[model samples]
Target chain A: MKFRMYLMLPLLLAGLTAQGLEPLSRARLLADRSAVTPGGQETLGLQLVMAPGWHTYADPPGDSGMAPRINFKQPSDLRDASWRFPPPHAFRDAAGVTYGYENVALLLIDARVPPDAPVGGNWTVRADVEWLICRELCRPMFATVELELPVRDREVLFPNWTPLLRRGGWPAARE
Target chain B: MHKAKMWLGIVAVMLLGFGARAEKQAPGFELPDVQGKTYKLADNLGKIVVLEWTNYDCPFVKKFYTAGAMQELQREAVARGVVWLSICSSAPGKQGHFERDEWLRRMQSAKVAVPVLLDPDGKVGRAYGAKTTPHMFVIDAEGRLVYQGGIDDQPSARAQSLEGARNYVREALQALWDGQPVPLAEAKPYGCSVKY
Candidate 1:
């Protein structure tokens, strides 16, 4: 039990850091449900955390900033139904104003699952994303995220994101 | 006569190639440094000069200064009889803008010997098309703009990014000083957007 405790301490600390404090940014893909029913829509999201003084560009991140983008990598049958983002704040620069997120931002995507997907089977959805984070200098960050879901009964992780999922449902245009 | 004709054609083609590579006359500017000295670009005519865009708070700039990469390059440039001028184009109330006394103190503390010229209105930065903090430009003795781009190939903000990357600014200056055409005349700069 003592050995197990020692092992779990680092894991707990790491989890906390990943959740709240990261060196630059920490990103993870999440799903609204643990299972996908045939002919149903699935909502996917990226949980992104930014460290102090760092910010990522928003959609339409003005003339000088690069907007963050995500691409589906696996489960070829999945098609993007919609991409959603929260409103971004305008940060004034010397010559122009840029739109971006400060502390954290949730990027959501709604995907349509093929109606013929077999029940009782497990499927993994993979995503690749590119984002620019800047405070003093800028760094381009690429993250590969995956979320596994079952077609039948399984443990659901939706409860954790229920509050956030209830926020704005469509991509924001202004802030 | 045929041999001479071929040589003439070759020279003409070479000149055309040079013309298409974004060369232009360097713009003139008179800006006050932290010490209140006005530096007129025209005053430095007949000597090779390097223009550097800088923001002290920028991580990309730190990647060079913290490692002494920029200082070493500045020393080398001076030794080669080149005048290096560092320009800060951040407008008033922007992230990198600083008051005169504080700016002087910071430069002195960092041991950066070059003049940190203030471009509060961004007129000079716009004239030179400086996009990012640390954008670099090299002007030849004849006042022709010969090179413009990033300091190096790797654009990462981390200090380790310096490890195998080619320093474009250094390479360009060396080539120009050697009286040879710069191998790569222009490369897209990568860093935080200039506050201007």
Candidate 2:
């Protein structure tokens, strides 16, 4: 057990900082369910934890900056229904106003699993994400994140992440 | 005399309103190049002028520079007798704000052939409403501000976007050369906010 725990340490750390550019931001995928049922709706989250003083842009980044882009690459049986981001904070620059998320941003997407998907198998969803994070200067960073869950006959919510998903359902837009 | 004065006042007000609605005349200013040579906008009134808001450190501007896209455009426009002026509006002590020596080095390394005008005070930039590093403006030979916006449609900072991307500045110049109205006179300029 001790040897196994030592071997798993790096893996756990890797999960925590998965696809992160040093001194910028960490990105990882989170699933609301431990297992997904075929023909059921599921929620997936792309979590971004930015370093202090850095931010990623929202859609329509106002006078300048590019918005974050995500390309799904996994789970052929799953189709994205909708994607939403919580309201972002407005950053006023010398030139104009920019809308972005600072510190931490969780982007949620609703996906539907096809009824014909095979049960007892695993479903993995991968996303290729790109963002331009800026403070004084901007850097274009991209990462690939994956989340895997077993395909079960019944829905099985993952306790830890499900509450977060529920509580953070799209907040009111900022005026 | 009273009626004539009243009519003149009404005409003046109408003219002011029309001027406000019409395309603004490009503001005239004199700025020094990296070599300390002065360039006055009024002196170039009879020639087409292109104003390029640039900041080398910004990734969006860097994208065009690294891909040689921006240089090619400048050369093409200059070869066609259009005066191309690269303006840096970054405030002092900010990114892309460089001394004359540094500016010379950067231009040499980047093979920039056009004159780079320094607007460290940002007066010219603000007058032109330049909000982004790569914001572009084209003035016709008659000194009217004809176009102002992004250099192109691809807003990403990635150099790969240069491939097959439509060059708006080129299109505007082509329209003017062909005596046709510019297809896209204005677009949402995208890039890092000007340091000013």
Candidate 3:
């Protein structure tokens, strides 16, 4: 029985390692709401769940470090959307002060759809994200996320989810 | 096994304590300014000295200078007999590092009233562990580090926020003038990371 258990342990450990070994740390994309109107303004959420004691640089990583950069790719017919980064926390080291998020940071992005966008279909939204995660040392992480939303005519999608989308820095509407 | 664990815990505590101590002392060094005048920390004794690590290309630095926040601080500190040295530690080929003449031109254009020191090799910056553009430090008359860290609490790239945050340099100078301990000695400096 002992010999048989030993053989099983290696296989179990291998399976566990395989399950745990994700290239990047905790990364997920969440929407304030799962649904949206085809031609309306809605909030989209992107969250990076980093490993313990690791952090990503905030945008424009002023003299401190590299800030997180996001690239959104959608159909040319879709309206270009913008990302809202929250006020960043400052980091100080022997090198100087840098802006970044420690541990887990919630980065909120605002997405807009044209009023004439297609209705009654799922539209694909993809984002390529890159950031530097640092503890005592720094590591660069990249992730690509694709989200699908069910579109409806004029109906506000995820009305209840606005709070989650409001956490990061969002620009005021231009006059 | 219990004894061994106790020994391990003791070692861990000692290591942690050492790390804490390591974080407290200011980094050291020597660097020349825009005129090729070398400024060394040890030479500033008997005077209240201020160190402003700067990068001209950085927007945050621009905000302070363009808005007269840094100059105002420099004028005020100098009036109180503070030696304000603006040190640029940008490495060669980096964004902020410039020739002495170019640096002088930039300073003159910006109306910078303080001595603009150069650290092209970054020897002084590394010694003092100067990290960000606009990182600040205050050394007392006795040549002991009195205060080190950010210039203020706000970290925006906009000069509009300067009025709201408490200026660390001013506070330190005041404390020295009044013969009081600096109320807040160290804070997290915020700005563009020093291009080291």
Best candidate, TM-score: 2
- Alpha-carbon local distance difference test for all models: 0.77, 0.83, 0.70
Clashing pairs in 1: none
Docking class of 3: incorrect
Report DockQ per prediction, comma-separated.
Answer: 0.15, 0.57, 0.17
Best by DockQ: 2
Rank candidates, lDDT, best first. 2, 1, 3
Candidate 2 per-residue lDDT over residues A1-175, each given as its tens digit:
9999999999988865744325488678887788999887877888877888998888788878888777687764344445577787899888878998887777887887778779998887888777888898777777788888889999898777744543344444222
Please give the interface root mean square deviation for model 3, in Å.
7.0
Among all candidates shown, the one with the greatest lDDT: 2
| Positional deviation of residue A58's Cα in model 2 after best superposition, in angstroms | 1.2
Candidate 3: regions farther than 4 A off? A1-31, A34-175, B1-28
Off by over 4 Å in 1: A1-25, A29-131, A134-175, B1-21
Model 2, clash count?
Answer: 0
| Model 2: residues with Cα > 4 Å off, grouped in runs | A1-21, A74-82, A162-175, B1-22
- Looking at model 3 chain B, which ten-residue stretch has the lowest summed lDDT? B18-27
Chain B TM-score per candidate, please: 0.87, 0.88, 0.84
